[model samples]
Target: MRSIAIRLQELDDDELEDFVDIWLHNRSALYYRTERLGKTSDKGRDVVGFVTDQLHEGDWDLYQCKRKTRGSKLGVGEALKELGKVFYHHLKGEYATLPRKYVFVSPRGITGPLQTLLLNKEKLRTALVDQWDETCRTGITRNEEVPLSNVIRTVIDAYDFTRITYLTGTLLAKETDAGPALSKVLNLVPDEAPEAEAPETVCEVEMVYLDQLREIYGETSGLAFTTINDVLAHPVHAGHLQLQRTRFFEAAAFDRFHRDNTAPGAMETFKKDIFHTVIEVYRESHPSRLDRVNAVMKHIGMTQVSLLGRMSRPPVRQGMCHHLATDGRLRWTR
Candidate 1:
């Protein structure tokens, strides 16, 4: 069996064309294999393959694969270039006896602009859908008829969205059930009360703390008054010390104090000690430190027990440390 990672990596242009061909031919025997018919003699054709029991008579389809990558497109220019080859082969009576069809397989798909360009062209649009339908049916599933609607539905079903909202309406929609539940669990619901009048611009100590919090975490970390208050009240959090001090202190003084009091490796040692202590305390203390933190967080209006549990987990040597470093909760450069 192919690994998922390998399968994901294998889903490039050629594989996609093969996939489409397999789907179209519906060859249950699975003897289908794609071939490159020589760069020089093949002309425009990139892949040539036969599906068993496609037709009572000798019936086959030829496809020109234009596997576009990022920022690459299959425009009218390229389509016309391939079409010219088809015209050349037709004029030479190469496919006079056999039923022949021309196809352009692009994984990224032909853009709307290019589709319009093809539609506007009299010759290209004339039998495009019929030819494509015939090709797909004969190539992937011998006699089965697969509608365009089915194909569209397949593509639409592949996507998963977290949020859905109307641009023009007051109402909002959520695409996933888990999203709303998780949001509610995290206390992220928007207030339904009447919009308060905009406050006059004024400097405040709370605003300064909010800015500091934003700098420490990030703007979207949702550092509200309740979250900050909870963080300060938590005895385990080192930030609690700074919360007690005034916000107007100089950066130099703060840095000097931090450097002088905390030894070079002391912070890491302290962090480890605190982590172990939390785990030991939880294992030994009555009601447990984990229960205490959860209770405290809940008292401060957080309903997410899962988040608290996650926060209370003992730090392992691997993933969590890396995560902490990546998220700027732990320093690595020092």
Candidate 2:
């Protein structure tokens, strides 16, 4: 799966909220009895869900879900303010039954300062303890007397913000937490190194090839050709020749010879003798007249014009052979 950071960046505001709703739904049983009640009187409350238990007659819990990027921390002030809105809704007869519990959910988790605030705030503290107690009785153990901040941290520690959000939604609908299951499926080790970085720009590979080409041939010679094949075939001014380049030249020569000649059964004989010689020279240079042989063969169309019966050739035939040798350009070589 792609990183949470990457996925979060792709989602818009509404998508993010929907994502949070889904994540909370999947990861926590607390969301099982809750139904998303839509927008609250407070803008801070992105989602309002009513929680009911068998023991309680009506709404037992109220949840305020907040979604943010990983590494971000939500403060106590935000938690308190959200709680106050829930309380306000209760007082105004909006939820006449009045929720017995209040909960805050954040993707990034809550800040340390917020945790302290929750601990100190009498009403908020009671609501959290009560919620924790009820959840514990139902075999859903609260890992700790965690504040809203700690809850956020736990989610972040176990899964990335995006995955946590995704899990929440899955849990809500299925009554199952997908995070732990996903962790097992992924089989990720905590200490493993992250994946290798992707190349930042498109031109990087091309630039590297150009640099290597220039190092083998002179910089001036490297820039003289437009096609990659031309650059590959050019002799390396450097002492050592690349094995890769040598193989390329032989392959290119073999293809060119067959392509230029229209004569039937020409390639069969040519491949046996001339092609064999070309391949040998391409591997290791022979000292005497070997360079001259290569130059001459390249000067004429190596495979195109064989030492055939005729001493005289037509103008167009001569031009075509010459063009094949010089890569379709008039040769200046003496």
Candidate 3:
């Protein structure tokens, strides 16, 4: 919450408008457009969103942002003044229609008297009329003294006071849940618990050897070794295969950690290192099976087969390797 308050304090008018846009967008499905009126002639609104699902075809929700211009807190005078602009504009038809919701967003918040007035919907019109001369009448117009005319009074009286809403910096921060997407923009960590580690997506390492073992057994027994399933389904390897599944998940967790934290160019470097490790392990475990490694790499899309020497196969293709790493099937460090 402190982080959100600090972030709000740092935003200028443009940034605050954007913050409102993002916050509103994250919290609902209503599409939002910002600064519909140019910076100089916006009346009182900064961000506007449609209330219904049909995009621009619905009732409008106007969001007016009032940051602390020179004061420590936004007082009643300031709150009433901005609200007056909205009311004035709606009377003048600057807004095609009165907004269904008129929201005020500020870091300093509304003054205590105004806060109380806000709680009682029925009294808002009377309060605004009573305070209009000092708080809003002369303040709203620039050229001539636009006093609280009978027309303005009628508009204010007929206006729905229930449409008014206030959002302080702390309240907005508590309600907004865009998580890292928002946090990244603000350069702050999200106010949520860390996520649990996820397992990787690749196939198990031992499963890679199962086919070769089936071939060997078939050749020895003088039977057609068409599938590793036939050999591995035997009760003998069933326990060992189950153990290999555990290893696969362990490999997945390690890959997930690396992918989560790996910097941009570092992933390429890591892949190269893992490929070399795969080569070294394959050499140690299946020295005569370099052909198998070559086949595996080719199957995964390592197209530069000519690069493979008479002795060694190239590692898996970079894209495929990353995919495997992401899946948790490919682990280099056993």
Clashes of each: 9, 14, 9
Cα lDDT listed for each candidate: 0.36, 0.38, 0.57
- Residue-level lDDT of model 3, residues 252-321, one tens digit each, is 4433433332222333454455555445434355433324433444443433421111111222232334
Top candidate by lDDT = 3
| Candidate 2: tens digits of C-alpha lDDT, residues 1-334 | 7654344434444654554454445434554443444453342345444454442246455445655555565655545445434433343455555444555545455677665555555544444334432332222212434233444323223321111111222232232233322222232112111122212232332333334444434444434554444555666532222332332234334434332321234334433434343434334443433243334345333334332221212222222322232341222121
**Candidate 3, run of 10 with poorest lDDT:** 305-314
Q: After superposition, how far is residue 84 of candidate 2 from its true place, in Å?
A: 1.2
Listing every candidate in turn, what is its Cα RMSD in Å to the true structure after a full C-alpha superposition? 20.9, 23.7, 10.4
What TM-score does prediction 1 earn?
A: 0.28
lDDT of 2: 0.38
How far does residue 115 in candidate 3 sit from its true spot (Å)?
1.2
**Better by lDDT, candidate 2 or 1:** 2
TM-scores for candidates 1 onward, in order = 0.28, 0.31, 0.58
Error of 3 at 157 (Å): 2.3
